[model samples]
Target: MRKCRFAPGGIYHIYNRGVDKREVFISESDYIRFLCSLYRFNDIAPTSNLHRIAYDVRGLTSNISDKPDKRKRLVNILYYALRPNHFHMTLQELIEKGIEKFMQKIGTGYTMYFNKKNKRSGALFQGTFKAIAIESERYLMEISRYIHLNPLKNIEPEFREKGVENIDKAKDFLLHYKWSSFLDYVSIKNFPLLINNEIHKGYFKDASQHKDFVFEGLFEVKPRTCKGIL
Candidate 1:
């Protein structure tokens, strides 16, 4: 594990990969199912029927969006990114063991869905999701940048280390990627219901400002400076 501690009001960067570093998100349906799972299993209430509601006959992932907005969330999902093999998330704990509860439900629920659909068994994720406590405000932004920039791997596997070759192309790819909260943070409405954007209120003036920070600010930061966050 990277770092371990779950305290209320503490923010953490949580992540995990598939067993053997296999691809956990294989198809569009798989991605949508996992995304829906993030929404359905985030609450303090017991997740009944699980992914069944997320994939009913009428809709694929849209069905789960119909859930009422009143359910209490265990953690405030600050930022997240789902890659082909692994996943990243920055969460602000809202209650006791909030991060633990949310991670456990997402892991167990998604593994069952993945295994049953793929006709495989045993643990789907690695031992457990790792955690990195964000001790300061500056580290929070850096961690979120690291998480959102992860999709660069899909474009160029070496972008993280060598820096983006074409800034515009990289920015376009990130803006269009639907899996991460980058789009939402930019106020482009990727998955507004899945995240709590209120946290960015005092930090950024508006969406485009944040979009600049994500695209331009990190673009200039030498990969060496991003060592610990990356």
Candidate 2:
């Protein structure tokens, strides 16, 4: 079946798994590299040496800017999480077809780096990746929570099998988890290029409200409830 196309300005749950469900991150460094690539591609850092040439000067100079000499460009990173074999992200597109370009850059850039590092051939991901547009503001928040909770299913399966007294502590483990955007959301660790602070803050109109939502969602649902999404 043909997959759906991502629309500009739409919030999508974008994800991909390793081929054969194998471990994509063999070491902690691999995870860091992958996350760095996300920020790098999203224009998170000041244009890299090459990016400065490709998209900044030569690349954009041809495209006329809407504001006099200023070139028109749109791209931003919203939220993302990294796991062993898979990853998830919530993105807001700023330009027409920006999502397509962004994903292509990330995929191609990471694959080259991963293959060279591991001395492996072929693709790292299973396929072209999947994206589901978040239909409501409610789902937007819900899915973000879901993405952050993915690592729990992998690292702390016991929290689900046996009831833990300190559910807050279990959730705290997630807060400190460096592999996902959970840290970014809480502002404990800042990943400047990985996410757009302005757009991300908009997800939580009230900090207390968002925290309650995440906490309640964690406890109310059986921990095993995440099996499917993971």
Candidate 3:
């Protein structure tokens, strides 16, 4: 586990996978539980039972991000995509050490949930989550598209190397995939209460524009592979 240098206002791409490259999320409920942690554990305060907490709104985000601190947040979850074995997130630290604290909570909380559900007692994830700072807007824009395009690998196993075979098919899959925040970012509102979309929204003219930006990358862009820490 690398000791990540998290500073206030810095944006980074953080990712981790299951231990031994195993599947961490084996079912739908498993994925949703982790997603709930993304909402339930962002606060500076400690809490549990994500199954009950995600629905409360808790006023953590209150639909007003980047505002005066009514609720102190550890980090701003700009974007995220949850794969079967791994997960990816683009985050901006709201306070110093925010990312580190947030990741620890998420890792610990989700491991407990997963282990209990499966009747296993062991670490679920690999080493500490790895982070890479998004140093430029170009990288941010590219990473946003890159993250959204991740589902395409399920459809076209070699899409990144061979390029998308059918752009229409690619769009259709992404339009329906609910695990990622891609739908919400594109005005679909799959999970409105789950993420703070404002920071990334500022990069685009509108949700339609954001959707367009991601769609265009299917055939035109070949971003570097976003690998798991495991």
Candidate 4:
């Protein structure tokens, strides 16, 4: 486990990978389930079990249309991306131990559901999730790009180190990727209710500029610096 203290009002990059780098999301349903967990497990108060709710409503559309229940949130999820084997999030802790509690709920709850569904046992994640504090505005913006561009690894395994090979294809893939908040951040509003984008709204003039920043700006950033603090 990484040693880092989470503070209220502080932004941190949080992530965890599957055990042995195996796939955590196996199907479309699995991806949707994980996304639902992200929305349902953010509360400071104990709420209905997502697994039970999902079981009860099996075969129903996983698109959660209900408004997030009114309650104090554990953390403000500013940005997130769900990859095949891991997940990434940029969160601002709103209360004491907010990030810790939120991660615990999602981690434990998802692991339990996944194990039962797959008929497997033992730990699902590699270990304790990693948390890195974002120390500057540049780092914050850069980290968002890094997280959003993660899906590109599927087409270009070395994209992070070498940048996108086909800029057009990369942009298309990112625009269509359903598992990340890239769409919401770009103003498409896939799950606008789950994010607090005010902090990042001013960074880009509009969605087009943000798209350029992601696909173009990344190429200009040196690989070493682009890896960011995390």
- Give the winner by TM-score: 1
Where does model 1 exceed 4 Å of error?
56-67, 221-230
Per candidate, the number of residue pairs that clash is 0, 0, 0, 0
RMSD of each: 2.3, 7.0, 4.0, 2.8
> Candidate 2 — which pairs collide?
none
Q: Could you tell which candidate, 3 or 4, scores higher by TM-score? A: 4
Predicted structure 3, TM vs. truth:
0.86
> lDDT of each model, Cα atoms only?
0.80, 0.65, 0.78, 0.80
Q: What TM-score against the true fold does each predicted structure earn?
A: 0.91, 0.76, 0.86, 0.90
Cα lDDT of candidate 3 equals 0.78
Model 4 lDDT per residue over 50-139, tens place: 755552123222335554357678988998988889989999999999998998888898899889989999999989999989989998
Ranking by TM-score: 1, 4, 3, 2
lDDT head-to-head 1 vs 2, winner: 1
lDDT of 2: 0.65
